[model samples]
Target chain A: MTDLSQQLAFVLEIDKLKAVYRQTTVKEDKDRHENSAEHSWHIALTAQILKDYAEYPIDIERVVQMLLIHDIIEIDAGDLFAFAEQQDHAQQALKEAQAAERLFGLLPPQQHEQYKALWFEFEAAESNDARFAKAMDRILPLVQNMNNNGGSWAKHKISQPQVLARNKHLEYIAPKLWQYVVQQTDLAVSNGWLKKD
Target chain B: MTDLSQQLAFVLEIDKLKAVYRQTTVKEDKDRHENSAEHSWHIALTAQILKDYAEYPIDIERVVQMLLIHDIIEIDAGDLFAFAEQQDHAQQALKEAQAAERLFGLLPPQQHEQYKALWFEFEAAESNDARFAKAMDRILPLVQNMNNNGGSWAKHKISQPQVLARNKHLEYIAPKLWQYVVQQTDLAVSNGWLKKD
Candidate 1:
C-alpha cells in the first residue's frame, strides 16, 4: 500500500471511535449519551485550555495530543464508564492495552510508536503533562454530571465520597479547577445529584 | 475570574458542539449522523497521521490545533453542509464571526487571542499548516460518502464534478493525499456513489 492509502486507512479506522458510546450525556441532552469520539475531543480541548493550571509548566501541545489519543483504545475494548460499579478496572485495562496494540498498529511505523508512547504516558499519568491532561479528562464528566440533572451520578446512585475519591487528583495538578470540582460536588449533594450520606 | 475558571467555562461552553450534528454518519451506522465535535477529532487525527504527506515540512502540532478549533464557531452558527445548495454562506459567516467572539471570549485574553487567531488562520487556509489542515477536513467526508453507500452524496445528489471542485485544494497541499482523493473519487464514480457526468 502507498503512504496515502496507509494514512487514509488509519484515518478511516479510527472513525470506529464515533460508535463507542459512553455513559455521560451531552451537556444539554440527557436522553442520549455522548460518544467516545466527542468525549476525546472535549478532553483534548479541555487540556488545551487548562494547561496553565498544571502543577508544573508543560508542553501544552503534547498534553492535548496525549488527551486526544487517550481513549482511542476504547474503540476496540469499549468505553468503560467511570461510574459503572461492576467491572474490574484492572481487567479492563489489560483488554484495552491489547486493543491499543491492534488499533494503533494500523498506522505507519513512526506514528504507531509515537501514539503508543502517548497512550502509555496517559495511562501512567505520572508526568506533569499527563497529570494535567488526566485532570482535564476527569473534570469534564464532573461538570456534565452537575449539568444534566446529575447525569450518570444520579443514574448510578453514585455517592459524593465515591465521586470525590475518583477525581481528587485534580487537587494537586490543578488546584484552582479542583476548587470548582469540590464546590460543584458539594452543590451536587445539596441538589440531590449525589447521595448525602 | 481566575484563569482556570475562564478555561473551565470555555471548555464547558464548547460542549454544545456535541448537539450540533453534521451530514455524515459513522462508517457503518447510518442510524445516526456524526457530530461537529467528533468531526474535529477525526480531522485532527487525520492531520496528525497524514502530516508526513504534506508538500513541505509543517509544524504538525500547530496544524492539529488549528484543525481542532476550525469548526468550533459552528457550535453557535451551526454546521453548513458542503453540498447544501440554498444556505446563505455570507450570512452564516457573519453569524459565525460573532459566535467566535462570544465563545472564545470566555477564556483569558491570551488564550482567547490565541484561539481566535488559530480559527482565522484555518479559515484563510493560506499557510502550509492551514492548507494541509483544510485538506484533512475535506477528505474525511469524501471518504465517508464512499463508505456509507454514497452517504450524503446520494442523499444530496452530489456529483463527481462537484466533489472535485470542492476538494481541489488538496492537489497543492499534499499531492500524495490528493492522489488518494482522486483515486477514491474515481472509484466512487465507478461504484455509483457519484453521478458520472
Candidate 2:
C-alpha cells in the first residue's frame, strides 16, 4: 500500500475511539449534550477566540495544542465529575497521565514528544499557553450549563457556591470570559437552575 | 463564583464529551485505538515536528490550529470506517460540519468566529497550513498501524492499491512524512501483518 493510503487507514481507525462517551443532558436542553469530540473541538476553537485576551503574549498555536489534548486523559480516567469528591482528583490525574502516554505515543517519535509536551504544559498550567488553554477549558462548560439551564449541576445537585468555588480561576485567566460566566451563574441561580447554597 | 473557576468548570464539562469513544479499538492495535482528544493532540504535535519538512514556507500557527480541530466533527458524524461503503463519506462530512457549527458556536461570539475559521481552513485543505495539517493527520495513524503489525488493515481486508489510492496526497503534502509512512507500510507487509494483495 502507498504511504498516503496507510495514513488514511490510520485516520479511519481513530474514528472508532469516538464511542467512549454518550454526552447526555442531565437537566439541560437537547443541544447541551455534546459528544467528546465536539467538546474538544469547541475548546480548541475557544482557545483561538480567546488567544488575544491572554495575560501574556501567548502563542495561539501552543494554546490550541493544549486545548485539543487537555482532556484526552478523560478517556481512560473517565470524566471525573468535577464536583465529585476532591480526593479522586489525584487518582484521576494519574489515570489521565497514563492515558496520555499511551494515546500520544500513537504518533511517530518526533511528533509524540511534541504532543506529550503540550499535554504536560496544559496539565501543569504554568505556561501562558497552558493557563490560557485552562481558562478557555473552564469557560466552555459554564456557557453550556447556563444555556442548557444548568443541566449537569442540577442533576448532580451541585450548588451555586460549589460551582463558584470550583471555577474562580477564570477571573484571573481571562477576565472577560470570567465576567460572562459569573453573569450566567447568577442568572442560573435566579432562574432556580441551581441552589443558592 | 470567580470567573476563572467558572471557566475551569467549563473545561471539565467539555471533558465529558470524550467518553463517547475514548477506549475503542478498531481493527488497529491498542495504541492505535486512541481517543479523539488524543488524536487531535497527536496531529498538532505532528504538525510541529514536521513543520521544518514542508516544501513551502508555511504558517506553523495555522497548521497547528488546523490539526487541533480537524477531527472534532467526528463527534457528531460518528466515525466512518474507512473501508466501509463509499456512500458514507459525504454523509459523514455533512454531519460533522453541522456538529462543528453547534459545538464551535458554544464559544463567545469572537472566539466562535476564530475557531470556525480554523476548522473551515482545515476542511478546505486549500492553504499551505491546511496541506501540512492534512499530511500530519494521515501520517500519525500510518505509524501506529505499521508499528502494531498492520493492526487494522488485515482485519478490514484492505488492499495495498486501495490504501495507496487514498493516501497519495501525503507525498505532495509532506514528502518526508510520506516517505516514513511508505517505509513503515513496507515493513508491516514484510512482517506478514499485511497480505501482499
Candidate 3:
C-alpha cells in the first residue's frame, strides 16, 4: 500500500476504537455519557483556558499533548476510579504502564518517543506544563458535576470529604482554578448536591 | 452547607465525572483511550508543537482555551464516531449545546460567559485558533492509530477511503500536520498495518 493509503487504514483502525469508548457510560448525565474522543477534546480546551494561571511559563503545546495521550492506557487496563479502594492501585498502575508501552509502541519510533514522553510528563506532574495540565484535568470534571448538580456523586453516594481529599493536589498546581473548585464545592454542599461529611 | 462547601462539592462532582471518563474505553490503546482530562492536555500540547506551522497568526492562549472546552459537551452528548453513519449529524451538536449550558453554568455568571464564548469559538472552528485546535483534534487520533498499527481499524473493518475522507478536513486547516499524517499513513499501509483499497 502507498503511504497515503497506509495512513488512511491507520485512521480507520482508530475509528473502531471510538466504538469502545461509546459503549462506556457515565452516570453523571441521565441522557449523556462521555466518550474517549470527546474527553480528549474537552481537556485540551481546559488546558488552553487555564494556561495563564499556571504557576510558571509552560509550553502550552506540550501540555495539550500530555492531556491527549495521558489516558490511552485505559484501553488496556480499564479506568480506575480515583477514589476507588487502594488495594488495587499498585496493580492498576503496573497494568496501565505496560499498556502504555504497547500502545505507544505502535507509532513510528520517533513519534512514539514524542508521545511517550508527554504521557510520562503528565503522569509525573513535575514540569510547569504537566502541573498546569494536571490542574485542568482536575478542574474540568468539577465544573461538569457542579452544573449537573452533583449528578454522579449523588448517584454514587460519594462523601464530600472523600472528594476533597482525592483532588487536593489541584490546590498546589493551579490555585485560582483550585479556588474556583472550592467555591463550587461549597455551593454543591448547600444545594444538597453532595452529602455533608 | 456553606457556599464554600457547596462549591467544593460541585467541583468534586466534576471529579466524579472525570472518574467516569477514566473508566470509559476506546478501542485504541490505553494511551489513546485517554480520559477527557488527559485529552485536553494533549491537544493543547499539539497546538504548541504545531503552532509555528499554523496557516495564520494564532493567539496561543485563545487556541489553548478552545481546545480544552471543545469537548465538555461530550459529557452530555457522548462521543459521536466521526466515521459512524449518523442519521442526523446535528443531533450531537444540539445535545452538546445543552450540556455546555449546564456545565459552564457552574461557574460564576461572568466566568460562565468567558468559558461559553471559548467553547462557542471552538465549535465554530472559524478563527485561526479554532482551526488550529480542530486540526490537532483530527491529527491526534490518526497518530494514535498509526502507532497502534491500525489495531482499531482492523477490528472495526472501517474502510481506508472513509478514514482518509473523514480526516481530510485537517489538510485545509493545518497543511503541515496533514502532510505528516499522509506520511504516516503511507508507512502504515506499506507495513500491512492497514489494508489497501
Candidate 4:
C-alpha cells in the first residue's frame, strides 16, 4: 500500500525472474539452463568489465541498470530464444511492453517510470548506454555457447551466418568485441562447435 | 595473454558463479535454491531501488559494482551459510581472499585490482556504499525466507534473535529497511512462519 510495501512487492515479484530459464546453459552446470536473473547479473557485470571496449563514451551505471532490468519483462513474457528461426518482433515487443508496465508498476511511481523508460531504451538500443548494454547482452551468451561446446547454437543447429547476422550491430556498438566475436565464431566453426553456413 | 583475452577469460570464468547455489530459494520456485549469480543480480538491483533509504550519501554505482562482484569469490570459496550456528569467518576471509585473487585475476590487471578492492570493501562494510550494498544483500534473503514460509530459517531452526542479530547492521545503514525488517519479523513470528527464540 505504501512505498516500502510497493518496493518490497516489486523485489519479491522479480524473484520470479530466477525461475525463467534461458536456452543457454551455465559453464559448470551444463544440465541446467541459465535463468533470467543470473543472466541479468552476468551481463551487467560484463557491461562494466567491457566498458572500455564501447565505441562511445557511455554511462556505465545506466548501462548496468539497463542490463539488470532488461529481462524483468521475461518474468512475464517468458524468454524468447535469441536463435529462434521465426521471431515475431512486434508481438514480442507488445508482450514485453505489457509485462514492463505491470512489473515496473509494482515500484513507486518515480521508479516505475524511470525503470520503464530504461527498459524501453534497452529495447530500442538507441542510446550509447543502451547500445553497450545490448552488446553485453548478446556477447555473453555467444561465449557461453562456446563454453558448453556450442550450447544452444549446436542444440538449435544454428549457423555461423545467423549468429553473425544476429550480432552484426556489435560492429558499430563495440568494434573490439565485434572482432572478438568474429574470431570466436571462426574458432567455433573450425572446432565444429558452430555449424558452417 | 592480451587484455582482451584476459577480459574474455574473466567473463567466461565467472559463469561458474551460476552454479554456486545459496541457501535462499526463489519465490515462485521453492524447490530450487537461489544461485550466487542471481543473488548478486537481485541485490545490485535492490541497492539501486533502495538508494534513497541509505543513511548517507552513497554512490549507487559503487554499491552496484560492489554487490555484482562480491559473491564472485563463491565461485571458488563456495557459499557460507549466513545462518550457520558456528561460522569460521576467519577461515572464510582467508578462502575468499584467495578466491578473489584467482577469480578477479582473470581480468586485466587494472580490473583485477579494482574488483579485488571492491570485494574487500564489501567484506569490510565500513564505507557508506559498502554498508548500503551489504544491507541489500542481507535484506533480500531475509524477505525470501518470509516469502517461502520462513525458508532457510525454518529449515535450519533459526530464531528471531538470530535473524535480528544477523541483520542488526541495517539499523545504522538503512533505518527504514531495518524498521521494515523488525515489523516483518514480528509478523513472521505471529504468523508462525518464523519461530520465537
lDDT of 2 by residue, A1-197 (tens): 54334334434433433434534342222343444544666677557645666655787877776765666666566676767687788788888889878766665565567778888888887776777787776666666677576777777877778877766666676677666677877888898888889
Best by lDDT: 4
TM-score of chain B of 4: 0.95
* Each model's total of backbone clashes: 0, 37, 65, 0
TM-score, candidate number 3: 0.57
Chain A TM-score by candidate, in order: 0.93, 0.84, 0.84, 0.95
- Per-residue CA lDDT of model 1 for A5-99, tens digit only, reads 66667777888888888888775543587888888888887777776677677888888788788888987788887865555787888999999
Of candidate 4 chain B, the 10-residue stretch with the lowest lDDT total is B83-92
How displaced is residue A118 in candidate 1, in Å?
A: 1.6
Span of ten consecutive residues with least summed lDDT in model 2 chain B: B23-32
Interface RMSD of predicted model 4: 0.7
Best by TM-score: 4
Q: Label model 2 with its docking quality class.
A: incorrect
Docking class for model 4 is: high
Candidates, ranked, TM-score: 4, 1, 2, 3
What is the Cα-based TM-score of model 1?
A: 0.93
TM-scores for every predicted model: 0.93, 0.65, 0.57, 0.96
**Residue pairs in steric clash, candidate 1?**
none
Candidate 4 clashes between residue pairs 3 or more apart in a chain or in different chains: none
The superposed Cα distance between candidate 1 and the true structure at residue A191, in angstroms, equals: 2.5
> Mind giving the per-residue lDDT tens digits that candidate 3 earns over B1-197?
54333334434334333433432234444443455644554555556545666767788767776766676667666676666667656787788889888887776566568888888888887777787888777777667666566755655666666667666756777676677777777777777765666
- What ordering of candidates by lDDT runs from best to worst? 4, 1, 2, 3
For candidate 2, lDDT tens digit of each residue in B1-197?
54344334434444533433532243423343555654675567456555777888899887877776676666567667666676887787788789888766665565557777888888787887787787777666566666456767777767665665556667886677667666766776778766667
Candidate 1 per-residue lDDT over residues B36-138, each given as its tens digit: 9989998887777777777887898899888888888987899988866655777888998999899999999998999998888888889888888888889
